[model samples]
Target: MNLTPESKVLIQGFCEFISGTHVAQMQAYGTNLVAGVNPGCGGQELHGLPVFDLVEEVIEQFGVIDTTIICVDPYDVLDAALEAIASHISQIIIITAGVPPLDMVQLLRKAEACETLVIGPNSPGIIVPGKILLGTQPSEFYTPGVVGIVSRSSTLTYEVAYELTKAGLGQSISVSIGSDAIVGSSFLQWLQILDEDETTEAIVLVGQPGGGSEEAAARYIAEAIDKPVIAYIAGRQAPPGKSWRQTGTLATVIGRDPNFGTAQSKLAALKEAEVPVAERPSQIPELLRKEIKIN
Candidate 1:
């Protein structure tokens, strides 16, 4: 949600091997990580931060935590997230990969009912370049600036940010909405946030071939977003099954579903919406610059 330098953060299922460096890096980057949640490890210290047995304990001791970064075992992600939501943490970022889709479905229902914002089951989370890091986004690629970047591909998110930074276009915020098939957030959700954000001047949407998300984003941008927007859809040349890693998208490989989740359709939708589409990550800066100038 409204992440800032002062946002108090906690980690769910905190593990030294999985989350140690990230914790240290977040602290170094100025993120206000107040505590962590790892059952049976309560009262223990890792990375010089307090670890709690439960999300409620962390809340009771630290007061309101703004975000919780979940890095538990794949199967444990659901319980970890439910605990965070129950604790009333506004933002939940799930970093564990390979979470069963059913678990995500359940988490989404609870999150929506509680008005909670979940980032990913397989995500890099959100970063406010030079301000705070909520997940494991590499800090080397980002800088403080006006553009807001949102992507389904974590690797592409980094490459795009590096390109933007290289072109002297730093980012106001960068969000990896998770590469999983059933993520908590969507392109339209973050698009609306960026459009209304005072610090964000433009938006870069990095999409993949699978799913109708890119097409949905195009429709939303056409009607709702006032700020300039540019897009780069990966997997244009990727064969059906190889296009995306998500299970649902992988089905396209066998079904050859031409009407859905095709890169051609995504590009057509974005083009029809008048959104500039970059052929490559390096071209994003140039297209974004053109969009900003025109708007």
Candidate 2:
């Protein structure tokens, strides 16, 4: 079930007041925005797609969905995700942030039980340049190329991609798995997928001040992925002892200590794993050219 230009997508939180603006933007980017689901707003339409009150109804009326991009209220993210999972939706990109950490624990547990792939609980989503968009990433920064980007810093993802695109290093895909401690997806998960992707020759990882997934990804890259990876970790200028609060933040909130997951710690791990680290976004193109001879 590859995410391609033809994949049919459903917007779980479609509405007139909140998601209309971004829904319109997703439509403008040529994403196959096939249907939407908003409980009370069912029987209506957005961007020529029918609206349904339940995932079941959406499936019943419009066939199955390839992916569901969620932009609902923070509190409702778990329920929306559960609905998609129950419906056997393979790919889900959640763009809502600020969900309670405990809520994600339950959501992830269900996703695992159902064998579903969940992308975010606070993310910019995933984009396959010239193909499909599953979240809110600005499509202008992307174009079909060999490099695939996976990031935790939403804004930095755009910056690096724009720089790369401007340098003729257009990307094959760019995905943000959210920087929050208890996100639905992981860097390793996306890395593994990109590693197997024939379209992606190299990978660019963007890390941030929080989470230990970056460090973990470095280990996975060392032992697992065969593709050459270029990395840029943000918040290096940030004070120490700040990040990694969520390497297991929810776990901590649930009464466990997941210490040693800081920004500095993550950097050391990546360097130890031998993934080339970039100091600035502007320098990525040169680094890419150096690593892969793209120039």
User: Estimated TM-score per prediction?
Assistant: 0.94, 0.91
lDDT of each: 0.86, 0.81
Candidate 1 lDDT by residue in tens digits, 1-295: 6588999998877643255787788899999999877899889988778888988888788799899888898889999888888888989998888888889999999999999998986888899988899899999899999999999988899999999999999899999998777889899999999999999999999998777889999999999999999899988887754556652453445565465787888999999999999999999988887777522
Q: Name the runs in model 1 displaced over 4 angstroms.
A: 15-17, 246-257
The candidate that wins on TM-score is: 1
TM-score of model 1 (CA atoms): 0.94
> How far does residue 106 in candidate 1 sit from its true spot (Å)?
1.1
Superposing all C-alpha atoms, what RMSD in Å does each candidate have to the true structure? 2.2, 2.7
Which ten residues in a row are the worst by lDDT in model 2?
Answer: 243-252
What number of backbone clashes does candidate 2 have, counting pairs of residues 3 or more apart or in separate chains?
1
